[model samples]
Target: MSRDITAVFRPDPSSPNNNTFTNITPNSGYCQPIPANCNESGRRFSSFRLPIIFRSTAAIQAGHVDPRQGAMYQVPASWRAVQVANARTGETATLEIRWAGMGSQYNLYTSAVELVGGGVTPHVAHQRLWGGSEWINAPAPCRDGRLGHFNNTIYTFFWHTSAEGTCAKRASYQIPDLYFPFLDFGYELRTPDPLMMSSGQYTGSLTYTVGPGQDVDMGDVLLPNDSAITLHFNLDVDHTLKVDVPPGGNRVELAPQEGWQAWLNSGQKPTRLFRDQRFHISASSRFKMALECQAISGDTCAIFDAGTGHAVSVDVSVSLPNGITDPAGQPVSRRRLLRDGSGTELFQAGSFVDRGMGTLHFEVGRERLAEMLDNGGNRYTGNVTVIWDSEV
Candidate 1:
């Protein structure tokens, strides 16, 4: 089966703070570095202006197989190739496939993988197969760089453009040896750990094991025309998924108060089936919360207090969704934790404070406050004022 994949950004859908993923264009300072072309170009160029070319869908076929057996029939696997049409040259450049379909620990069906192109091996001269016999050298950073074939059916390749600065070529079909299969495979398996909190915070951790899938862990930025990778995820059972809140703090809660049932059942475990693949799986918890706050005073300090109101104390307590426990698994005493009381002024003032007079105080002993902090200190202190009138 064929599917479409898209890129995700850092400052995502929820908060509007940082938008590194938005307004991305050629030479926008955030584009990935130029790829190291190993063929005969003898130059370094960054292809940052390649558009994504994707096949509409993939076609999976099967031979005479018994339905009761529940086995996948062999299919003619091909690279569902996509291209990044260079805007400058109006030419459709060939993009290399990096991570093929996801991989599995099982050796079943050989994983349907392959890699076919020029200079796929190391120490070999670049053989331009696309435009002409332009000799390019092997990629400079050739540690993990090279043409890769998985299970011998899925073909994938990765290369860097050699230009002076970060820019795309004005010609289409610029990169030689650029042909990718239509699809690879996709499968996803997830295990959820519900982290219960005593302070009414909804939270959980999902342990995912993707088999027969590709691993895509390049630098912070993704290279242009980098082939997409995919995985199939089958959930064993659908359970109530929700994010925890910070005590009484106002945050979007994701709890199924009523009829919130999972799509999958308990007996039926989710299984990931691989196929013609080029996709990515990004799993993040929607049930997680982050705190943001500013430090009113220049005191970057973290002070601990036992439920006791003493100036300082030394005690450890592990808190859960329902209760708190000491190192010996016994119930520990409760207390408030305050970093710098000066920062709480703005929140408690319920309004704007002028530069000099208002002071902020944060308390943690209260049950609600402790519960909010338990949801992962999503709320952090921030500094809104650079130059204050008076010091705390």
Candidate 2:
């Protein structure tokens, strides 16, 4: 929904005529040639004679929609707000507000309507913020990303190749100025609220179908504080699966197992399903796979596939903490590793274990090396996860 608010203010008593107390004549001998004065009539106090003007200083707080049962999903919506300072010298000015867009509507006396009617309109007039409905032609607030708003601040978290960021999402909001024309009158907008209504759908589900039900062992992983990860699954069949991660669910965090260094051998292509990061295996600790699935299904099937459908490439992502270095000493970073399904080159053919995710074995003997001549190089810290597209 979109709307525009217009605030209008006109001066009440705007005349300095009838000079009974002062020695001034009625528009004759006040100054030299009145016409030539360049300040006559309308020109002679045009500001005082004019009506008080006000530009609408309005904003939309965000509102949220639940998306559990709808086909049309709601991407987090956005809106713009503008406030016009009171141009007149009084506080009884009325502002005309209008909006245009999909499913658009508004309330003139917002406080009155909300208090008496009990609706979406905010209880207070100051809370009538703006919100977005359509997604096209909106303002671009990033160098190479789509703009998004949360908590009244505009931010961009979209991924772009050239930007100086990782696969991780980031946000920022601009603060608005406070003091304004309302102060001239004894009453002013003292408590301008900054909270936005949550308009985006916080809940949604993705659906996928597995042909004839192969051994379905995949389950959701609840991470500590992280939000991204890659799951390494050993599949005997090309099964179509859907993995849904709720927005409110615990974020995924991959931590290295205790005493990780002792078990890592040089010649042991000791491949692990999970890693602490995208950097070399040595720089991070690893973990054992803890899948919550049985080997066989009641359908008596040991293998699973999307019902004889050819394996297709599904897109996925992995994120890691900063400051990881490559074996060649290059800075390591997180990125998406694209792959085609059930391919042996990326997976072990007969073993059903997909190793296509490029490996990150470490050669770091026990001594930690320094990256710079300064103090010894920073120790590798933080976690990493691999991400891949999965069937619902």
- Winning candidate number (lDDT): 1
Model 1 lDDT tens row, 1-392? 21222222332224322212221112211113322332223422222222322221212112213221111111111222334332333433222222211111111122221112333432121221211211121222222223333332223333332211111111112221222222222211112221111111121121222111212221111121344323221111111222222343332222222222331344322121111111111111112111223322223322222342222111111112212122343432222112332322211111111111111222223343333334433433222221211111
Candidates' C-alpha lDDT: 0.22, 0.20
Q: After superposition on all CA atoms, what RMSD does each candidate show versus the true structure?
A: 26.4, 32.2
TM-score of each: 0.18, 0.13
TM-score for candidate 2, please give it: 0.13
Of candidate 1, the 10-residue stretch with the lowest lDDT total is 347-356
Candidate 1: segments with Cα more than 4 A from true spot: 1-155, 158-178, 183-193, 197-392
* Candidate of highest TM-score: 1
In Å, residue 121's CA in model 2 sits off its true spot by: 56
